[model samples]
Target: TITEICDRYPARIVDVGPKVAIIEMVGTESVLEEFIEEVRPTGIVEMIRTGVVSMGRGTRIHDTNFINRRALADAAAKADSGNGRIV
Candidate 1:
């Protein structure tokens, strides 16, 4: 199972359980669609996507967006105090 996924696509296993496996493949949209088609026969229970994260070719730093560490910590603390809700 793992070998087939690895051979067909450069996917990283996120989690594995008795009935499902979550994987992530970082690549072009076409490649991602093709991989989905290839894996359709194996039963996909659910899929979640965070949208495209992109950068110019040959750039120095990754083009990821992130909250400041302190801001994140503050939000987390608020959520914890608010019973895990982000309000």
Candidate 2:
């Protein structure tokens, strides 16, 4: 279902782990916000707005390490118990 939802937008799922995923979507801030809202209800325990790449120059303009380790751990636990879905 997550894959289906992402396919509706200009998004690429870059990577996926047991409890986390890296998704790259090309859009404006508003579009990003809308995407977040769209995916929030799909059992996504945590999401980190990792960075943005400039479309014109293909350069990263912003980056951050804003990950929530506790949430990720919790999500992992839930997935291990079949109570969560990795997004």
Candidate 3:
């Protein structure tokens, strides 16, 4: 039922628990509003429970080691010179 709801709506399944689901709909906020209104009674937990800790928009986790090394080097330089803070 949860999968069906997500597929039918323009929503993303953010998280799923044994008895709950957290979701987000990109556009058409009205659709998501209606979904929440109807599904809230189903005992599903919302992401708001955790205060919605989300990565900033367009953020991506890079698995490349070289990129990570560069980032660390830049961070060290900035910290040593008090030029900037590590992100």
Candidate 4:
């Protein structure tokens, strides 16, 4: 059923586990709502929605400071989340 929804809409099943499936989707608000309706019966325990973050029309998105990852190793991820690698 999820595969059918993905085929019919602009969405991707990013990850699935024993108890959860993460679907990343992009569409107009109404379209997303429709997709949710299609999948709602599967029981949605959690959901995360992405929102637009705009710096402005012509502004360039800034990149973080250059860090030589080889020098930092595991410390980089640990610093980022206060835990090990996220996934």
Winning candidate number (TM-score) = 4
Candidates by TM-score, descending order: 4, 1, 2, 3
Candidate 2: tens digits of C-alpha lDDT, residues 1-87: 667878988888898887777787877788888888898876767566756755533233233222466668878988878856664
Q: Give the better candidate number (2 or 4) by lDDT.
A: 4
- Model 1, 1-87: lDDT tens per residue? 754865778788888888888787888778888888888888888887667877566543453433366678899999999999987
lDDT, residue 54, model 1: 71
**lDDT (10s digit) by residue, model 4, range 1-87:** 777887789999899887777888988889889998998998888888786544533323232333345437657766778655643
Q: Candidate 1: minimum summed lDDT over ten consecutive residues — where? A: 58-67
Better of 1 and 3 by TM-score: 1
Q: Which stretches of candidate 2 lie over 4 Å from their true place?
A: 45-87
Candidate numbers, best lDDT first, in rank order: 1, 4, 2, 3
Tens digit of lDDT per residue, candidate 3, span 1-87? 777777877787887777666677664557657777766666654344233345744334444576788888988987878856554
lDDT, candidate 1, equals 0.77
Of 1 and 2, the candidate ranking higher by TM-score: 1
Clashes of 3: 0
